[model samples]
Target: MTDVTSAPRELRKGANVAIRDLGGELGGLTVFLDSRGHDGETIDADVSVLLLDASGKVRSSADFVFYNQPIALNGAVHLRDKLVPEPDSDEAAAGWSSDVVTLELDDVPQEIERIVVAASLDASTARTFGDAAGVRLRLQRSSDAADLLVFDIDDATTESALVFGEFYRRDEDWKIRAVGRGYQAGLAALVTEHGVDVSEEADEPEGPEAPAVDETPDEAPAPPGDAEQAPAPPMPAEVDDDTGTSSPATPAKRSVSVRRPTRAPRLPVDWNASIPADDGNDWQAARLFPVAGIGSGEEQERRATSALLAVMSMVREFGAALTGRCGAPRGTITTYIEVPFGQDEEAYRPDGVIQVRRGTREWTALVEVKTSTGRLNVEQIEKYVEIARARGYDAVITISNELAGGDADHPVAVDRRKLRKVSLHHLSWDQIRAEAVLAARHRGVSDATQAKVLEEFIRYMSHARSGMGGLGDMGPSWVKLRDAVKSKTARASDKATGEISARFDELIQHLGHHMTGLLGVEVQSLAPREAPDHASRRQQLADSGLMFGRLKVPGAVDVLVVGADLRADKASAAITIGAPRGDTRPLTRVNWLLRQLPDEAKDSIRIEAHMAGPRAVSTAALLGKARQDPSCLVPEEQREIKAFTISLEVPLGNKRAAGTGTLIGSVKGATTTFYADVVQHLRPWVAKVGSPSRAE
Candidate 1:
């Protein structure tokens, strides 16, 4: 099936290849865009293709850059029949998702002379292609594995989009050229360059609007911006025969079409329905069952504090959409998570505080978080309400595991001119989770960091046993999961292995929980290093005999935990810091942090600088390197799951500690030391990272 003269070709910027040599056997050309951002992180990118005629006039185009749409707004009849832009494919590899355009050469019209393929970052992400790593373009035949052209972009740091290459007709022969041109203004600019009408779109409202239906001429102007200028087709003037007089025509009456605003869909389940009347403060009760010298009770309290702060942080970052999903007065909402109150820093401190500002005037919202299974007391509510009122707050919110007997309208606000009356309201953690899911799905969240935080927080709470709602019971609680698997009778063959793996998974979950409770920060489990090779990845994690985990705390260099070879009779604790993926300024931030730490503090911890090149490490290389140094931290192991191309590892506790029992205590002690180290070095770093960006 091969053509004698046809051959695959690789290309760089400004290079060209003859399409005639691509072969007559080629039925169609497939343009594949592989977006590798950091460490398999989600980077929403758009791939568009433009069809041009001989004179370079654009005849048709295809793209999926609009909200909720995965394909071009309009279809080109000359292109492939299947117009799905974000077509699902089984071949998508780890650390990379692909979008493809198929060109049916046989179906291409004779007038079509060229096709240009391009990639762009969505405006919502506020990122450019340069912000993304390892973006690649390839042209090849669908039937044949051979590639006609491959373009690996080395740098596009300031550009949002770039033309990877183009196919064109040169006299009787078809040829391909490596364009590699960038568009800093994103896809809009690129489309404009290809003759798209972007000016009309620019004039339209920046916010989302409902689709227009058949409407009267008078109402048409209120709809689309383009329709505002278009004059309705004129009607002929009416004449009265009896008087032989000409009269101006009256426009025909049109039907009035009115659509109500879309309402947010209710959560699938009433989150409050399953809440037990009494929880006996099980979160705290469970903490009483501590392993070794770790004060589980104190740890749980700290975790509760952290969880509260995390919630406030989400509310703070997402603002009205997150905290006021039920509704808030129209204005910018700002929140401070766990900030001290009163004139003194050591005075009364609340879990969270919010300020909704409308012009010069502002209303305050004070929040108290309770993660344990407990009911809000009338006295506590009254006290907090009194405190809020005294502090001039308009509202007081208490977050707990159970829903109080009241309507969904909790934390309702009544605005007054000078001072507003503070209202008391109780919110269940499940409610927060539900709102986050809703916001993520329908609110079109733009900040990648906020989105990631929301997602991770949800995952963290899903496993948390205290909350009430779908998140409370949809899956087995960690305790129930551990018990169910641990109680199963041992068997031979396949079933035995499954049981063992299930038990191991529980151990991993316990480790995550232990860390969350102890560290008072979000901690997540990671798949075993050998997970990819197994059909049942969960089982692989158990079989790997090494527990791996990640930490998520803003501004601090990412930290990781790897339990020393679990299969070994004895193990020690290890924490990796200065993880590079997701952290663009890893070196600068980490070095700055290290410098601030006292000499004695720095000398106590083992620090290794595993710096590489300026460019991000490829996923394959990272994985291989991980295998080479099991003790070394990699990007995939980081909280954001990015290529921590460079990092530092600090092993806690001495190798003298042995036995599984000692492992727990050793880890507990090491974790304590690690926290101290982080507080000394990383806390200040987080403060710097979280501060507002300064004017350059």
Candidate 2:
């Protein structure tokens, strides 16, 4: 609708003009939506573009009215034609702006004769243009960067949708028309008029009987107001129109839970090298930086930098592992390492980028890696945050070797006020390593060959934790520790044995810490209970069931205090998966306790059929008690059942010399293997069952 009469050229409400007059070389047009609250506050509204054929019938359209998934069609001629509705902001309502619809004129199909731009109040909020001080559409021409048209609405009334303007072809030329038409109904009604298949809230079942996931199409009986509208056909099922009947309902779709794939199948660690063996040997291969003593100044710097980058690479892999651990379906999250951004050589590069998607929902996270000694500055973090926000990343996580200042378990805060919608977190390398070990262990148990690379990576991390400094001096502590274990004689002084055994103490303590951190429990090492003499302490330890440690892990019904024993010299470690004895020892419900364990634990860990010793209670006796009185299962009467007493250990090396170095090496290797075994064994129990419950 254009007028060639003596009409004002300046665009205003209901103004009609020729687009050829606006710009001759216009290749593209960007339509922007602007609205201000009564108090001059910016308001967020949906802006859309619709293309129509010569007959005024809809050809192709992009709108934010349906589930916020605006259609975007890419064209070879002009690249892209799409709608950028909102900038994924947390304060989307308060500071809302940037809802745009871009149209490449060259990309528009020849059959399309007109382009219509419109706006509507965001469906989420119960507000209309009448509640705003101003609502307008601004058209910008791409060729000359000119503001071609501005159509402002004045009489919005109680209307929620409005057609601001249109660009139409007239007599082999393009013309603009400011068609200020408003609809009292909301966007759904407005979109329906232009042929958009949007499902209405009323179509959804209102009662609790509704299925958790509705795979079938909504086909409820139409209300009086919508009697003219036909019901949607059930998807993936044919509709029989012969007798006006629908086919048998499609089989109810089962909701599937997903687990994402790990990124690194091959690690940088060399696994052929043996663990420390004898008192005399070249321990260079075991050292992270063997050339620390031989390299020149520049060579040393280069090597150090290279080593740091290698560590960062591992950190990147660790982030990829973390993404997989979030339980998304395989291929749902893809990781890109060392992805560069910004203008040139001085560009910002994140160590890794994790792209996650499940159907239409998609998001991204940037990972920044740092060593324990490296500190993240405000300026650098600010820059990364800015870049992450600009690139539309949901989160920016920094994986570092540095522990959190306040709490080791909690993430450290990077000053993130400048990041409007981007979340920032600091995860310690220790935590990442732990998670990787556990995840790799689970994968390893299923298929050891496939998980070899990840297992090697875990081993490398464990070995590197032995104080390998920043490529300075090849630390003697680790070598000395290894050597000390190899040189110990059979009959050493009591003082010397206790002092050397402290290494074992540290190793076991570390295990306790790892277990405590993972299980959210208090794990304690149980030394020979206050024995009077060395002879008495050895006897006490022998009679203590050789149980060296206990874990008091909390559960729904009661606290599960489990004990485990693993001597560095022994080939097996025993874990008693049962509750500690108390006043209600005889009333334990063995069957219910067994049910609590996942199938993996039962299959992997050897389960004892019946309890032994006078203190031990049989599963048959517990079942009889349970049968005699169901009340026996109550909290007060029920004792913790030793569900099973099983040995969980793998051969590290043959019982070598009792020297400190050999002993330490033996414990370290065994502990590393056992960690994997335990994590893999307990995974099913700890993993989230399906998904969190939602209000129906």
Candidate 3:
């Protein structure tokens, strides 16, 4: 204890730091750096923790002292490095991430297990995060098909990755080679600059000696060349996922109904027919160009232009909107698009071209968007009037400025009115979900309260006005709703004190096992009761003959947990375990009326178990007489008064956090307002009582 090992230090450089590895074997080093003090506001320059060896020099140093302070990342917002793994069991309807979805191309999907797609629009730009528009689809399997793992697309942008339905741009006219005969013979020796060879079936072996996925210690090559990274077999394969939608031969209805994946399988043939389909009038302007309600396609305007390219990619202002019913695409002309039958390409990305410019004149506004509702035969509007008459353009439709002009008074003004793209809308779906909740709270991404004003719904289209800004109208997106409101305002500003000490120790062992089976003994101690000491209860009731009488019953038990010192503790008395079942309709016949008796009794005596367990009385109170009742609980036992839960353990250094969030609620009639984002684990107070009140 007298030798602290010869110490001394000195060193300096451009240095820059911030650390706190406490608990790392006795928590030493606590330095802090990045100068600029005295009100200039930036401090921390302690540095010392050296100790390098293998030829790097320095072997003994110690000065660092973490707990270091000084913070400010400007307006602060870096929600990255979330270390994935937060999908908590299908998450409330596809939350937490299924690559933020939206695909409904034409309805008919449900057999999922592996079906993530986005060969276009930015390799599925995280499907525009947040309310993943009717979510469901999820897929994750690959040794290295260019490992995005499942979306990381360079900090993920381009409007959050085109809502991830599909994207893969590189076809300089098509020449990546290798078209058919599928694959397997070692993926035909592997290759792809565009030769995009895809055999997909290997790595199958799932049982016996299931060990050879790859160990090598001898052979290795695959790195960024992920032609679908290989791991196991390559033969015995079986993939069945399903989802569907397609009808324009004569039956149009649908307004809002989702859930698809009824049949997407069959790949090996041109993999996915070279991704095309947009002709049913360019999927009615790509999924209804959202601003209110109605459709066209391009995935209903890919969630407000990936939510306005995550805020200000330039400028946007759609009013009244209302889409679907069909046709309304205007101005810039030049059509000729056609993706029939197999449409739902992740829910209809129509792309028939709709450039709407005039935000200040490059003037070019164009058109072609389409729709019919659902089943539209007659060759789906005759292949959209022969792809807008072989790419000529000039079919002005686009209705809803609130349906253009009915009652003959120009609805919400779109200039004179009378437009025609026709398939169904004149303005409905509750006025486009009421202007998409006032445009998702005027774009700050909702939170105006009154319970989020129906999340400001917006989508009812009719376009064909282009000056270059109709790349399928990418308008409002909110970076996963501002990262789900800054992860719910940093989980409501932290501190639940380990969820209130594990919900007060699981509600005191769930109401202390029904109060130790109604006092038949065996409770040892529950502690924490305080707030009562009238001279230590009159000096333990002046040496108990066992009668300090303080009877106040209307559902007794209020802080009288005499568990251990019952006069020298006869193993903790209060052992009258039996017969006590009352209250069938008391409390002034349910309105819970308690007007008298509680003026602070001196020796305590406020009786009323219907004035002694009702004995056979028959009703008569508040307005005169006194007793009348006989139902002391026994109608098939009676129970309903227990709820409170919380359980925390979160250390989150990654290892895929299996615990940590603890908090509980659902308790009634006393006090409750939890919801700091609904984390859970507390348990105490679990009443399912009903009748058994006197049990041991």
Candidate 4:
């Protein structure tokens, strides 16, 4: 049974409480600032953190972590990527945007006595906190994602920045205090109060001001009118003894500057775009990591492991992207292959090992990898856990073809007792490929050679001979369960039914990762929070003869809901978005949505209008017919149209492999096609300025 915690304790302004009182001995906490702009306005509120000493001031400028300086105190505190509301969620409907600040409390330096969390508006904008609504903070335990407390800032006027709260050390424990303090001068004044040196550059009307400061603020300020600031002392570059490759040069410690980080210039060529199609006579380029000689599963695993580790070691951004997810500190990463270890009387050789060094502290994780259809061996993983624990390693990571759930659940089961000392994580080959693509294609690497190497790795992993094809098989029980459900003979407790349900969940999860890589945005699979467990999902499948999933694309007008219906032998993808506000005429609202979609979308898509009332009359029509007669979707009784749902249905495939006639391919194809044709083009209708707030 899920733990039913009471409502989060709301804290009034100036209220303080012990962190232990809310949740005892937390590994870490996450502060979420959910801010909403006034109707039709855009608010770009940025959240930041400050690590202060006993004197209530930062020891150095590095102690300030914000958008420009994201990491502080050796990764104990960092600013996460701006969070977009889940599509179709209440937050999305209400136009809420969230900024997250993560605190690895256990990793915070002992000298840090207080951690302050604050938010600031873009200085270039005239809007203030008064122009924002629903500005609140929710403190959550990062371990289980449970809300520990909530504070709503209801009192605000003309303030450009606000200090929402702070965590202070009390003896050996920590305590949180809600501080609803505001600053009228914006981010410059806000950070200046926290010991950051802000430059006095005249503000530009069109562009943001450059509030430059020396990296180490403790140094004497450079003379005014100096052309350039001093750079940090560079460390001697170290070459890896194993691969004979030069590692990124470490830099001397530096303080933070109150300035936006310079954005990288766009590359001359768009590496992400596809090259022009060529005739059969075109020359083929040689790859950095060739797959031509791969023969057996062992060779495949070895080559894949070596290739991944080598690329990670060479590419700084790619390495940080992967290791950061594993809770490693932001620093130098070194990887080794076939590391030998001993636990009790047995000797073990894991596929690879990863080590991260930040300052004098280091974290290590052992990696075990498998390719193709090979499943993880529980005993082998358990032995790795033992080795990691005995050797004081931080984690043991497993890579295989299997898919884990959206919640990072491991595919292989191991003894829970053995994992007390060493954490274990699993990464699917699909996920690894997605991350590689996201880094190389979407998020560019700084060094051109490193970028080329990452691109080559992506190509190598994508090749057919690499054996990294993801989600190709839906398991042997797929056909049996499909027939059973269609014939009305499937039971909730049947083994085949459960397996099919699990695979369907995996498919949805894979779709999220795949779309995220392709679109360069985070796409999350919305697992039913009420029925998140395996048993509940299996029961849901048996009862409805339908396996359903929803993908939440950030900033999308509506959630993309996909379903596979065994009874109907069809798969469908749909999106439901509210109709245009301030427009009462159903035809006008229908035309508003129609204008966003292309002419081709009318063929495969269906449009439905949801009307207001107790009964809530709903009328639907094919897009083609609706285009000719928009009134067909509007209720004759003249009820108010509340929303519209656009959907596309395709024949469900019956086979197991992800090919032309397979279930996996059909569902994936339907979703991507629908998104490209419909979802990507549709923007939520915002009311015009000076328009009536209510429907006519």
Candidate 5:
């Protein structure tokens, strides 16, 4: 509950958050952001605030406390920059799949000491893709300008090895850049890299050290106006020791007071054990999928990780560990775990299967994993039960994260990426997460590892997901979720989620191939938009005349414009341009048009953004408006009735400019505008006929 009296004035200033623009689509953007506290300090262990289109009310609501995380903007992060419809393997690529504004260099320049490159993908652009193509890498370089057939280093795959290439040479300063592309979306660096490697990190005259990481060269230091040059070398250092040995001597051996032996992390089951050799081509195959997402070596790894997490979430819901308390921590405690329905037997273990001195009831659960494209068939459920029964587990459970799906009828499809609707009995992702955590902990997982796993679980719960979202969701979060009903309700879901058991009569009925489906390996619909609600929302969209969408996650605008940093006249594809605002000089039309849009929309595209205003549409908006507006074109005989004008003149005025100095008073609208080559274009469509209007 919020304290109304303590709310800040800014919260009351206005209720509107001008949204990003969309061209020709009814965007249902749902974003999650954390509101800062009144004291300007962030409230952490944060929560997500949603910008939702709940039945078209356009509300900004907070669902629940969400784990604090770094900001995520799809285009801005995941697809930092995209190439013009290119692939990840197109050229040399480095850095994270996220992070916009990466510093990139065409070539490592000589005389340079450091380098930084920034790359980004517009938020608006990112939302357009449900998912698509992968990223690739090419380590490009050249001994001579024409000698640039730089070697290709694909995303890492055990088979596609380009083990070693001179990432850096002792003499030559290498130049590097990454080119990326998407499905129907433009290409750009998802984000920029300050430096590719240790050496490329530009050194501060009085700052940090530089190491050699990237092939790109450092920035060239300009020649001193009248000073002689001095030579320098990479820094070297030495350490001192207290032992009788020299200062650089190694540490003396010490007795092991606490021997916490390290253990290897649990690894994925080898596909070869269960399935035929795939050439380990899942990543490569993804590149050809209808909607293959980023294929950057790291991106593939990330997606794999995401899918793995989804699977893990379900596993926990199925009860991987058997934990039994003597009611007290004293009775012998024992836990058994495994995958209930996974390809691997280890994943079906259970919790609470201990031999207690006082109690005899067994706490046995069979944790399982299922990777499928669509809905479940009951027969599959029985198979899982059989496996559980064979293992003498108390309950049989199934789970999976990537549930690729399709239409409601044929919801079960085998999706390689598992992008679909999912179901495992009736357990929800959170329930699965909690149970999995308990199971893992009972099974002896370390506290630190448990925390990391919990973190991933929270992220899986945070998307405005579709298709398999419900399966992962267990059920909707909004339903009967009162604190009182939660535990009881969860109990009900837990039974459903944990219903698999070899002894249940339903198991036999579920086993026959003719039994249809119960769970595991059946796909649900991953197709994002199919509900009839779209019809209602579409009507609302018509009334608004503005495309609306939710971010589903935090997002930013990434409009591509002919103009960057806002120029008087620029081109962009995102905005729809109308006739110029007035008969006034073409340049003056901006002020007139700026008044036409709602203040919110105005801020969205940043009209007159140069001046300090609450919010300004970006330069991309202005450029897009300019390029798309019909008014910018010449009239064609009877073919087009619209009229417009083009002229060249020196306006008299003063207008403060952006990125540069101020311009004062005009023979123009504001004498405060700046210098322009003497030509212009003008067109007017809006008829503000009434009284004397400032723009008119």
Candidate 6:
């Protein structure tokens, strides 16, 4: 392995470098397109990959992987979900949004000569790469998540599509080149150039149409001999359809049928069966992995490790979902508990070992487990990395209760030098449980027994005795910081204040992760647009006596804003949506929103109408009051309505624990209640077809 401590080589436009030159071998590599814009501008772009043959063209449509086709080549090339950094983390502070594409180089087919990584603006958004700042690509060795190369594209102008780089075959070796080329014609044209059949009619209904048939032949069919002697029906006369002029006939081209891969139907799980029935009996069903007698942290760790590993080995879908996130190729997975290893006369037994075998290749990782409130030890992790490196393992994975803030960074910082050959990764118990729920309940497990086993594992992990709790405490500084903030004496630079802020961010992240599992959709934590960095957010909290975070739930009308107001002793969740454009009367617009809410919402929700004009003030009214008059929320001056904000507030909890009357509980409860009662029911206003716009 090359010296990983060396600084990543920065490539200029059109520069080429070999993969071996940077990482010493061609293995699992990840391409990250980290994009940001100045002045809080959002760069809406999509990253895609094209696998090409020696002709520099895709072999088939299946070779293209993008938002629509996220995985291709049997998991050799996969476009991962967009990852947003925690609002207060360094990545978020720098305004970077990451889109990742993983490449299992060894798994790439022998016929594939090149892998191209490209990015393009979303067709719905009329924006170009020039609008973005610090648009760059980082190539990281997936095994260690270490950056080997970085390329910055500084000259993108009027271009909607860009080819950041490509990995191509070089004799018996693979090499990468920085190809910072741009296309103003956007994704379709760029992909077409690479031999993807760009079908504008792809969105149209599928299935073959019946051919027009003539029941009566125009004439008696010719005899077989006559037919054989007949010249092919005279070629249709060639003419310029646009100019009505004769033109030369051209040879017909062979049409290539590129069929999009069909996605398998997701089977539904019997969630009701998974839930235990309370019949007031002392008898309970026997579980595959029981969590009954866990008394110490060690016991909890052992049971959790054994149960999770065993399940991962049995359930194919669940295991792939988890291992794929750690950069392992799709393969047959085998997991073992308490794997023993020795290095330099020192013996070490990692909690588990995960080995994934694909064809002749095998990828292995050492796992360290921590249950309850056990924190990862820095020296312990460094030692494991050393052992993994000596043993030629690919990665060292740590599973614990501690939540990683941004970029899946480890809670404990280990020496960077030890991670050159072996990568280090962290997984929170909350994340593991969430993934399990998604796989078994949402994504579906094909085998009935495997699904049952996964469900059992989930039940065992959910048990309080298992000690795999999710985001339970706000840390020891919660009380003092809460008091100081309430009293208006918390300094921005105070150690306690920083701790509280960091923990609060973690709470918000965990909330999003939890919602993802429940809703079967990815929910993300976002920084308030006004405060882009942690320092500014801390200052904002110190000045306003409030901490604010936002959640971006897919398909929601708007990002949900959550606020914890220390001064007011309230926790609130709110969302703002634009008013219907065609409605002429304020009453109609007000009723438009009112009609979407359930009748019970009138009791606890508040509505605010934001009026147009620079100096216009928004009108506020409780939903119950607004239900009666509607005019209560309308401005007396009759300023045109611009938008409306619906919000719910609950008394903030003061304690630091997980259950009722605790700060974590209150925040989570408030967000969940707001979503269930309000956000879920509200739809974004869309202009109705054929509806006339009324003049103000």
lDDT of 2 by residue, 578-654 (tens): 43222224333333334334343323333342343566564332323434453444433344443444334433332
lDDT of each: 0.45, 0.44, 0.21, 0.75, 0.24, 0.75
Over 4 Å off in model 6, which ranges?
1-277, 405-408, 527-532, 539-545, 582-585, 689-696
Q: What's model 5's overall lDDT? A: 0.24
Model 4: which ten-residue window has the lowest total lDDT? 217-226
> Per-candidate TM vs. native?
0.30, 0.31, 0.18, 0.70, 0.21, 0.67
**lDDT per residue (tens digit) for residues 1-696 in model 5:** 011222221211001111111110111111111111122222121111111111211111111001111112211111111121112321213221311111112222222322112111222222222121222222111110111112222232211111111111122332222211111211111101111011222222211121211222222232222122212322222443655353222222221111011111111223114335778555643221122344444343334334433434333322222121101111233333332344344443322122222134333334333322233444555545555455554443334332222112222322322211121232323234334333333222335654455445434433323111222221222122222122333232222222211011111111111011111111111122443433433333223211112111011111111111111222111212333322344334444444333322222232321212254322223423643552432222212111222111222111222112211111111100110110001112323333122234
- In candidate 4, list every pair of residues with a backbone clash: 61-256
Clash count for candidate 2 is 11
Give the TM-score comparing model 6 with the true structure, all chains together.
0.67
Question: What does the lDDT read for residue 468 in candidate 4?
Answer: 77
Can you write out model 1's per-residue Cα lDDT over 63-128, one digit (the tens) per residue? 222222223322121122111222233223334666666554544566666767777674434577
Instruction: List residue ranges in candidate 2 displaced over 4 A.
Output: 1-10, 60-69, 75-96, 200-696
**What is the alpha-carbon lDDT for the whole of candidate 3?**
0.21
Give the clash count for each candidate.
Answer: 3, 11, 156, 1, 163, 1
lDDT of 3 by residue, 1-696 (tens): 011232212111111111111111111111111112232222111111111122121111111100110111110111111112222332322323221111111111111111112211111111222212321112111110111111222222222111121211121110011111111111111111111222222222211111111111222222232342213322312333453333222122221111011111111223114337656663333322334452445444344333322221112212212221122211121222222323323222232333322212121112223222211133333343334433443232222211111122212232222223312222322233333432343223312342232332222222222111111110122122223332343122223222222222222232222222222122222332222432233233233311111111111222222211122312111111112223323332212111211122111111122223324322222212221222321121233212111111111111111112111111110011110101111111111233323111
At residue 541, candidate 6 shows an lDDT of 70
Model 2 alpha-carbon miss at residue 196, Å = 3.4
Q: Give the Cα error of residue 376 in candidate 6, in Å.
A: 1.2
Point out where model 4 deviates above 4 Å. Answer: 1-98, 101-278, 281-284, 406-408, 529-537, 693-696
Query: CA shift at 418, candidate 1, in angstroms?
Result: 84
By TM-score, the better pick of 4 and 6 is 4
Q: What TM-score does prediction 3 earn?
A: 0.18
